[model samples]
Each structure stands twice: as structure tokens, then as C-alpha cells.
Target: MTDAPLGRSAAFKVLTTGYVGSTGPGVAATVSYLTDAGRHLIFDPGMVASPEAILAPLAALGLGPEDVTDVVLSHHHPDNTMNVGLFPRALVHDHKVEYRGDQWKNRDAEGYELTPSLRLIRTPGHSPEDITLLAGTPTGVVAFAGDLWWHSAGPADDPVAPDRDQLRASRERVLAAATLIVPGHGAPFTPDATTPR
Candidate 1:
């Protein structure tokens, strides 16, 4: 993979696309953006796509991987981090705790600044290495909350629920910091987004 410069200011755009899966119509992947000193930085690149899958949408935006300076993964799950190698020149970011031995030598989680407008928070629970990207965008402080809390399930279903105290703390952190939330596998939620029934 090649490393690119992270944008100094942050900006974001969402790309909604289909992912073939068993969960009925699968959820859309939320791709966040940051303007690194005028360049573009993409948060997570979902499952690998064929050349055709990448062309149309990207062309619509007039962007290609070369235009993407970095990719910050929220965790190591294949669904979230599978396309890390595709951007042959973009640097990959993730949390240190999520490193699975040597499988990810090029990934970094030490928390690099994506842009003056963005910050990365390590919010482990659903997975020990899960991290959320926090940014102050024009809308509000938006949290790219990767699987830390899923809109589809209540906190009770979180894999870390057995540790109620930790889960509660994690939830509180998200609620307190997020005025807007972008969850890993569901619709974007307003400040009132909460665990569903």
C-alpha cells in the first residue's frame, strides 16, 4: 500500500451501495470523507468491488483511489476492513488493540489526525479494537460509530453486554459526544438515536 497525505480540513460525503448478503437487502456502507489540505481521505472501503462496481459511482464524484489519500478502519472485521489493500497508495488507520498479529503491518491505530476537523476515538466493546472517528463537521460533531452500537439491536444484544458496566460506559461516551451518528450497518441517526426495541 502507498501512503498519501491526510487532508488538513475535514469534509464528508456518504456513498450508498448494495452488498450481497443474507440479511435481506443488506445495509449500505457509509464512506466518510476529509479534505486533507485539499486532498480527499476516505474512512473505510467496504468489501472488494469489481472494476465495474467502482467505476460509475466514483466517476459521478470524479474520484478514484488515487484521489483518496487515506483509509481509516473502525475495526478488523472483513466487512469493515476488507478493501484495505485496494488503495495501493493510501495509508490505512485502525486501533492498535485490533491488530491480529502480523496480518496488518501497514495499518495504524495510534491515532493520526485525519484533518484539523476530525479526531479518532478508540471505543472498544463490540470488538476489543473497535474505534470511532469523531469529527466536527458543518452539521455537528458526527461520530462514525462503527459497530460500537448498532441501531438494529439494543445494548442488550451487544457482544460485550455481559460486561454491563463497560457497555453502559461505552454507550454514554457515544451519546455524550455525538450530535449526529453514522452507524456501521444502519441508517444515520440524529442526536436522539438510541438503542432500538
Candidate 2:
């Protein structure tokens, strides 16, 4: 519910508490920057609520789907990429080799730039399409680790199995570079907070 600027990025955290008449569940979306070029980047459009419900808050941040120049999807899951259609003009970015049979036609995951302050990391964990975002902040390099690492009660309980060993490797890849970790559904913390050092 707090719309505050984190560093040079216009970041907003919209908390949707679960209850009757509520907006599903808690979630947060980060808008990477307010550019002089009239462009902005959004990361992970979650499923905590319908895109319509968050329109007002998004507008308050001087953003609407039309104004968004790029959308970085951490994965193909509904919670992350479902609202993609809302941003018809914005280029969608993801690591999914093939996302939902052409829903990702114009999707570009080949190192698309997300503001001058951030870059995308292809991290396939929770799913083959999963990826983590790396951004430079005042604190340091913070990785928006979609479902790669949960920050709640414990580490990711359901890590991708050996069949998807690539995912586990991907986690290692990000952890190696990640200084701070911002998960998809929990509080943000340092990578060491979850890694056994």
C-alpha cells in the first residue's frame, strides 16, 4: 500500500490483504524508473488482484498500461504474466523459450534493457520460463527473484527437482551475483539471508 520511490526508480508496493471484498492476496510490483524519454519499466505483474483493481494506484504513479514501455515477466505463471495483455504496446520480456503458445509472439528475452539501471537474468526455477531481474540500487545489486527464492517462513520449500536441474543451477547463478534478494511474495532480504554461508 506504500507508493514510494526507491532510489531513482518509481517503486510501488501494493499490499492486497486476503479477506472478503479484498483484492485477493498480498503482492508487490516495482516500476524501475521514470525516464526523460517518456518510458518506464514494470516488473512482475502479479495475480493478487485483477489488473482493473490496481489501475487507480498505478495511475497515481503516473502509469497506465499504455505508458509502460516494457514489461519484464519473471516467468510464465499466471501470477506473473497474466496481465501482460493489458500492456498491448509495451514489449514483453521473459526467458520462456515458448510462452503459452504465442501469447508471447512479440516477447523478447534476449537481454532487453529495463531502464539504464537494470538488467534481466534468465533464472529458470519454479518453472522453465522463470527468470530473475538484476537492478542497481543505492544499497547495491538487488535481484528480483521471482519464485526462485521465497522470503517468508523459510527457504523455498519446493525447489525444482532434478528433472529440472537447470532450475537449481539457475538459482545458484543468481545467488552468486545477487547481493540483496526481493522475492515475488515476501519481504526483501539479502541473498546470504537464505543461502547457507
Computed on alpha carbons, the lDDT of every model, listed in order, comes to 0.59, 0.56
Instruction: Kindly report which residue pairs in candidate 1 clash with one another.
Output: 2-88, 2-89, 7-35, 7-36, 7-37, 8-36, 8-37, 94-109
- Model 2 over residues 1-197: C-alpha lDDT tens digits? 11111234423243232111125355444323223234565667666456655456667776776886766778766666655676677766677342332454544454544555565666665776677767655556677777675443324444433334665677677767666666666666666554622
- lDDT tens readout by residue for model 1, 68-144: 66677887776666565656667567885322325455444435455656667666767777777776666566777
For this target, which candidate reaches the highest lDDT against the unseen true structure? 1
TM-score to native of every candidate shown: 0.73, 0.67
Error of 1 at 144 (Å): 0.7
RMSD of each: 6.3, 7.0
Among all candidates shown, the one with the greatest TM-score = 1
What TM-score would you give candidate 1 relative to the actual structure?
Answer: 0.73
Model 2 scores worst on lDDT over the 10 consecutive residues at 13-22
